[model samples]
Target: MGAVTGDQTVDQTVVVAVDGGGSKTDAVAVRLDGSVVSRARAGGSSPQIEGLTRSVEVVDALVREVAGVAPLAGVDLFLSGLDFPAEEEAYRQAIADLPWAPGALLDNDLFAVLRAGTSAEAAVAVICGTGINAVGLGHGGTRVRFPAVGAISGDWGGGGGLGSEALWHAARHVDGRGPATALTEGICRVLDVPSVPELIADLHFGRRSQGDLRLLAPEVFRASDAGDAVAGALVDRQADEVAALVTACVRRLDLAGEPFPVVLGGSVLQAGHRRLEDRIAARVHDVAPHAELHHLRVPPVVGAVLRALERAGADGGALARAEAELVGTAHAALVGGVAR
Candidate 1:
């Protein structure tokens, strides 16, 4: 479907774009000319975590809340937990059945990072958030990706993984099985436990959920910054994993010699950790010499809006306007509570 333009009424074409991740989902409705009509934020909507039905329900609720009285021309979704083709097709059919729009475009959330980071025709995006994943677009529409289903999929070095590692080392140290480090103190402080054994008891006894371990990731970084040997090693390993993902994608897509944008995003990468960022850059440069690294500055949801606009044959001007407006709206929502 093409975007309605100039002479046509603005209300004739409205698109709702959503970026659904492991922690939260963001949705926005926009006119053909790039004006935002409405937006909403909701909790995590990953199919793998919440199940297909519940995930779709969360997204559908956000879409309706954003679309409101507007007649949607199309809907676009970039979501997490769609690791295989069957999952993608299932979600496509489910979303297609929704009456909110006539058609929908869907893909993994990594593409949102790619689109948000650059307009390059060929690019790679590495997301190191709660989990780690990557996607690459190459010449002739060639695409590369990872299963990204955690350790079983040979993936590692996300916040969840790092946090677990921190706890492991801390536990080992407390038990005299490993070298002492600041992580034990850091983890105990962050979790508000007096000792490692107490923290262990709490988790084992169900007083603390396993998911709470992710909260220790930042403490790992803090200890690393404070010159803790174990934390520094963990940070280095994370950098290696992130770089490995980029190297694999670039090689698989055969974009190693050609210049392409390598987009870095997600909470871990975007946390402004100089040590991690520098290590990643140096490692990526070793293999993909021509690859340019870009840290995503705006919300990945903006990329969903750009993709929808592109599908509708929007011009460069319209795309730029949409991006600018969406960035402002996201900032407003963050600070002023206007779009939540």
Candidate 2:
């Protein structure tokens, strides 16, 4: 949608880039010059799990939030995390059916972020927050993914899995099946509960449990830093898993070229845990010796914005400006804004 000034026309032909993650949705709408126009967020409504109606509603809410601040009635959307073709179609149809329709283009979020960072067709990118997913892109727009199987079953990347592992260690220690460490104490302190039994109870009752469990990840990291064997091993194991993911993507896809560009993102890596990230990077190299791992710090939304701009053909001076504006927004306008 293009921006409206109480007129039929919008402020300018713009590109609206959106990044929807499991935790939150962040969007940035910009004009040709890339100056900051409007930014907003809404609840996560990925149709993968969230029904079509709910998914569109959350996106609409965020779109409207931005539209209220600035118009997006005429912009093209470059949305991320829309991988499964079925899921993508549901979202595409919903957007097309909308009266506010601003030509929306959808693809896996990793593509948007990858393009935002560089022009590599053979690159691997990762997201390590609430959940973790990896993508391998080859020449002529080919991609491979290490699927996110979801919690209780998801692979050992992302905050949720790591947090769950932290809790698992604590429980096992009590059951006499694992070695003792400061993690049990750390978990108890972080949860603000007298004991594990009470913590489990808190999670079972009220509006607790599932979401708050990931809150223990940071505490686990802290204990590991202080030389807690249990915590350190857990962290190291997860890092290895992340490495394996990228390596598998490459081997499975048969990326015959020299090392592809590998990028990493997610709460687990970006959470001010440089030591953990460094360890993971090291492990990644060991697993996929040929790949060059890029320690990127760019926000995913900037990637989304870049894709949107390209889609809208609002390039040249306008593209440069819009990209610059959107990058600024990625840095300051939104919270936890990763590559779209």
Candidate 3:
């Protein structure tokens, strides 16, 4: 239930949605009846990750793909990407000039998460993925951010950060600068290599992709559970780092001593490490005893769509009705639609 684009045209059958991320861009175009009309993907498009030109290219490709299928001269778009004042302004200008109908609405991605929650007072969210950032919506749209500040500034909790840490330990151990940790031998074992040298050669020679390094996070977690001191310490440091960030967000917004919503996102926090979440919670409790943290166990895109609906003045009963219809629609689509 998005805001009705100026004069609903017969040419406005396409509804454009995006999950613009650091690694890739995912878009879906659906009909008014919630049927999957088409889908498309493009390279990374986050302004913080990719420059304006590249981000525009990705958005252009997505728009074309949606329009190609629906043949609609106009569309309704809901997007959640890297959000800053300049990025928001740039994206709004680009999309508004698309001549694609109904224009677009630009807001911070974390705002979407805040909109998804049922609470009215305050809700905090921390996304530990390619980078780390925290947001707290204290009523209205009041919010604060942790400002990831890149890896050099000690933001080591995301998938990228953990991967970097694993490699750092492996490289140090291999070079005899640090004691031989299980990661050094375990990684060599997985790659079917005789030694760390061969693994280094494969990595440096471009035989392994970026994902190859990210996949080792789970292995590190497993090895830590198996009593590897170095592996355990790596994960411990990660949880501690994220806990500090979340606590800072809560305290900065004066969300103390309440049953406030402390939401967690990112694969590193949700899927990559479950025990890490428990540790983070423990640390947070130690800092803010009255804070209640909630883990979102569902796809964030659903939350994003709901946020769009909320932004359109659909609230309370209106929101509940829309959620009922959309959830039912999504279920039917998943059941009878093409294998997605």
Candidate of highest TM-score: 1
Q: Can you write out model 1's per-residue Cα lDDT over 1-340, one digit (the tens) per residue?
A: 3436886644546888899998899999988777788889999999987899999999999999998877677888999999899999988877777787456787899887787777677888899888899998888888998898988999997888998899999999999999999999988899898998998999899999887888888998999999999999999999999999989988888877877788888999989999999999999999988778877778888878888888877767667677768776443322211111
State which candidate has the highest lDDT: 1
Model 2, position 229: C-alpha lDDT score: 85
Candidate 2 per-residue lDDT over residues 1-340, each given as its tens digit: 4555776655554446777766677887777566657888777655664666777787777766665544443543434446567767767778786655645566666665566555566777776777677788776777786446665445665677777788778877877888897888888888787877667667678646676777888887898889898888878877777777777777776763576677776677666676667777777666566777655576677677766766656545555565556555444432222322
The residue-level lDDT of candidate 1 at 317 comes to 67
Order the candidate numbers by lDDT, best to worst: 1, 2, 3
Alpha-carbon local distance difference test for all models: 0.85, 0.67, 0.62
Output the TM-score of candidate 2.
0.83
TM-scores of all candidate predictions against the true structure = 0.92, 0.83, 0.77
Candidate 1: 10-residue stretch with minimal lDDT: 331-340
